[model samples]
Target: MDIFTGPKLRDFKNSPPHLQFNKYVLTGYRPISTYRDCLQSLFYLHNEFGNIYTHGIPFICFLLVLPLSIPWAEIEWWIGVVHYLACLSPTICSVFYHLFMNHEGGAPIYDTLLCFDMFGVCLVNTLGALPIVHITLLCYPSSRLVATLAYLLLSGYGVHCAVSAQSNVHRLQSFAWQAIFRFFLFMLRLTGAGRGSPASLRLYLTMDTLALLGGLVNISRLPERFSPGRFDYWFNSHQIMHIMVVLSIVYLHWGTLEDLTWLKGYHCPGE
Candidate 1:
């Protein structure tokens, strides 16, 4: 079971420059590794071990189980499809990024992986909200169409900002417009102009709150920063954020499912 038969690990300072992003994680950094060496890492313990499995296990579970829970046949098939992809994207993208971050290909590859990780988050941010938008404007056909198009346009710009952002805070900020847009929709739902299960609004609110908290925790680097090297292979800020991100996705799924099920009984006024 021990595939890490060779290639000793490095310290924080010894790791590749790009891999030194976290000073709090002062040890257990994987060295510049070939493709095979990266694969071998799965069997051994390292700083990224927790990161890899935290998202990796959920990715597999979501892949296998979400489709069964989804209303694929009962609802508009596209909504269910998008929901499924939205649930799975962040985890899979994260797994790859964490797994190969120390690759011999170096910073360019690391940056590409970082872009991919951000892309996954953007997918969830964009596609996950489509159903909410659709349901909110279900009665107002014209507004639904316009809002959907506008949201997609906003998401497109968000993706560009996120991928190009040079800092963590900027990448988090890139999502501000989309979050504001979603908040507007939630307000509409609250005011009864928008339609959805009453329970779903609270779930969506919790989803965003957890995600925002996770982002802030990552940017601020708490707990780990307070005691460097103590959490190198365990409950560090990034790992904590990863857990929060997963929880946030669960809420997104719950809220969307609540709305989707509620959809079966509701019709727009005047329709």
Candidate 2:
């Protein structure tokens, strides 16, 4: 409850250089802090407070609440496991990255956290779609195996590019291959070459759309670009991106659940 009586906040000009990525966010920056001080900042009002809580609350909710909705016993065990991890990974890693980004360790710590955050995104991209691939190519075991392996290879490349990326645009670009491959899967579903819950394709499309939009908005730094300093503490491009990312995850969950339910009764042409 209101930890440390609100440490004095700084402006963009005074913030650590690493935290100055968004020049439009002209105020409400937290100073470089010790580990304990960073934790204490959680209770105080700062620009990052919105970023931390936006993903932090969802991480807690997903960790506790999503499992209850998952049919862990009904589906292929691995599908359930991957889906659970995919749903939880991004937000938890994001919470950590945002929460301690300004630690006294400075850029090295920040870079490590950024990589950790990218790894979480990588996990979701890699793990989340194993089920979709498994279900889509269910009728063709050989094709399913090849597609799954291909996607894994692509995701590995993406992870390398993302963690090593020097800018936000490059980080967003790193996931392009995986997204394109997913688009191919969606096309298969649309053409009836791949099979899933018919409803799922739409949800999956929406999921990707939201994610792409979020990345573009973040890269463009919109609204904030239009009015600097106005959204320093909330509703800025990054916060908006965070909200969109959460919604995209929800869509992914809904789509996967649809596919799983459809899987319960469907079979290959001869099996």
Candidate 3:
């Protein structure tokens, strides 16, 4: 199936300068193609095929199967909705960005796709943590509202920084504020100063840790840097980051589910 066959891919130097963000991925760069051609690339082998499929498969799974796993009837309606979207957002944007990155329109198209990709990540970080705030500050209504509002404001800055950033390092830096805010919430749960599923703290930690590591890995260009060109089509740093991003989202979902379940049986001091 030349569904598996295609035009010979270019080396990193041969690929567009903008798309050569990772010099270590020295070959298999897709040629600039029409949107339809990009769509067709889905069936072929390329460096980004793995990136596209890694997120693509998870996006579909979350869209179709996550609802069954979620305690929709038991959890707050909006929480379920937000969580669902948060779980799905990054992948939806990432698949499109990675697939069409080599669009015939060139760097402008790539930049736009990159912005959209960043926005998706911002959405996941912002939307995913709102419910955690609500649950953690459940007892203190005033504080809950304040914390949620503050976190949202912080995330707004994150989105701005992320979408407008000039480099990968800056892009990852944009998420630091949001991550710090989440760490505070995690501390609350840890110290019993706030409330949540105690079991979830570990999951949340794993989530953040994997996400941070993924970002660093992308920036540092690990295994790929060790052997330029060998990992051009598979196991490249960016691909590894994509996989880690999915795993982080999974942990986010697991931790959220634990909190929702605990919320059902628990109450605040005043309640």
**TM-scores, all models, native as reference:** 0.98, 0.98, 0.97
- Residue-level lDDT tens digits of model 1 in 186-229: 99999988999999999999999999999999999878999998
Residue 158 of candidate 3: its Cα lDDT? 98
Q: Write the per-residue lDDT of candidate 3 for residues 1-271, one digit (tens) a residue.
A: 2546877788888888899788888888888898888898998898999999999999998999889999988887999999999999999999999999999999999999999999999999999999899988888889999999999999999999999999899999999999999999999888898888988999999999999999999999989888988898888888899999999999999999999999999967766
lDDT of 3 at 170: 97
Instruction: Score candidate 2 by TM-score against the native.
Output: 0.98
The parts of candidate 1 lying over 4 Å away from their true place are: 1-6
Q: How far is candidate 1 from the true structure (C-alpha RMSD, Å)?
A: 1.2
- TM-score, prediction 3: 0.97
Error of 1 at 133 (Å): 0.3
